[model samples]
Target: MSAATPCVLVIDDEAQIRKFLDIGLRAEGYEVLLAADGAQGLALAATRSPDLVILDIGLPDREGHDVLSELRQWSHVPVVMLSVRDAESEKVKALDAGANDYVTKPFGIQELMARLRALLRSRPGEPDAPQRYDDGHLMIDLARREVALDGTSLALTRKEYAVIAMLLRHAGRVVTQQQLLRDIWGATHTQDSHYLRIVIGKLRQKLGDDPATPRWLKTEPGVGYRFLTDH
Candidate 1:
């Protein structure tokens, strides 16, 4: 499939529902990924970075609301929740937990497709990250995946680059340690703050940033790290 084609991940337990969505989404020209349960769905979501997600409210392994909570910790991908229950409370819970839309089971394919189209259209044409960033001292070309200090290229390890790139993507804002760990090292490493600390230290050292008087990277003390903008 072309890179521009939107990918949709459907996490549902029922074979019929999964089949129905898989066929319907593909027919509508959307690339489709299917998961039989919450664990598998979460795994795919972490690895694949699909454009959108259709999550079932009930799963064999866990409640979909719980899955949505875990997903919100790092990703803001649009999610349209599916459920057989049409209770007002259920819709409220899903929205409160971060789902973008809710569709009760037995939904018409046309209606579901319409909702999906609207959500996809509502997304920004570009991702949150800037294509490139350059200040007098530091430069980052996210499109080219390059970083330089004072016009000299810097050699960074994969983990190091991942950390710095994530920071630059959200420049001038705090990026929680758990977010860095989960996004770069995987969800299993979210509790391992020391890993993040080591990477942060190395990043600061390479960038010639002082932790005490940070020019680029700032420590949020017991919270997370933030990449300071030149302004």
Candidate 2:
């Protein structure tokens, strides 16, 4: 009910599984929703916008892959697939189709909860945190809007500071172009992706980074950019 409660949707036709997940997730402080088929799952996904989805490969209406295909059209919600088939090809297929992680059936509840926590920790909707970052070479204090490289302070323009601060806040994860544009440049500027490109270029140059083989910032091609954390 409360907006802060992390929500999990379990899409499985098996009644026992649904009941099991409902109790376990609730006990773990998650708001749980259940669906018996792909259609219901997709509907809940669209309407509820749950924080995570646990999808079963086999459904009465259709395959979960088809459900994932539809979900990927508009949503990038983290999905952990559940399947009885532990075959390599199935896991590959599900991941390729947009499943974030795969857990074979007969899994331990503790392991599943751990995976859920890991996914949530890395999830994009997470609020910005950990104000200070230092990897010896590059250091940033987001709250103070300060950055230093190799012990010397690096001068950065306002836009450069804003973008880099956001990137550093989400290190090791791709921050989508639209998200950057809207957050940094306002919602109306979402269509002006060129502005983001120009700003990012300047930031890279100041950081002494090469776009082709970036040490700190990596381009996600047409989608977005990710800050490389493993220096």
Best by TM-score: 1
Best by lDDT: 1
Model 1: per-residue Cα lDDT over 1-231, one tens digit each: 134699999999999999999999999999999999998998777656788999998999999999999888657889999999999999999999999999998999999999999998897553567768888789989889899999999999999999989988888766777778888998888889899899888989999899999998998765578888865
Alpha-carbon RMSD to native, per candidate: 7.6, 8.9
Q: Cα miss at 25, model 2 (Å)?
A: 0.3
Question: lDDT by residue for model 2 over 1-231, one digit each (tens)?
Answer: 244799999999999999999999999999998999998988777555688999999999999999999778656789999999999999999999999999999999999999999998887765556699889989999888889999989888888898998888877766777778888998788768899999999888888999988989898766678888786
Looking at model 1, the pairs that clash are: none
- Please provide TM-scores, in order, for all candidate models, with all chains considered together: 0.64, 0.55
**Which portions of model 1 show Cα errors greater than 4 Å?**
1-3, 125-163, 171-231
The true-structure Cα RMSD of candidate 1 reads 7.6
Model 1 TM-score relative to the real fold: 0.64
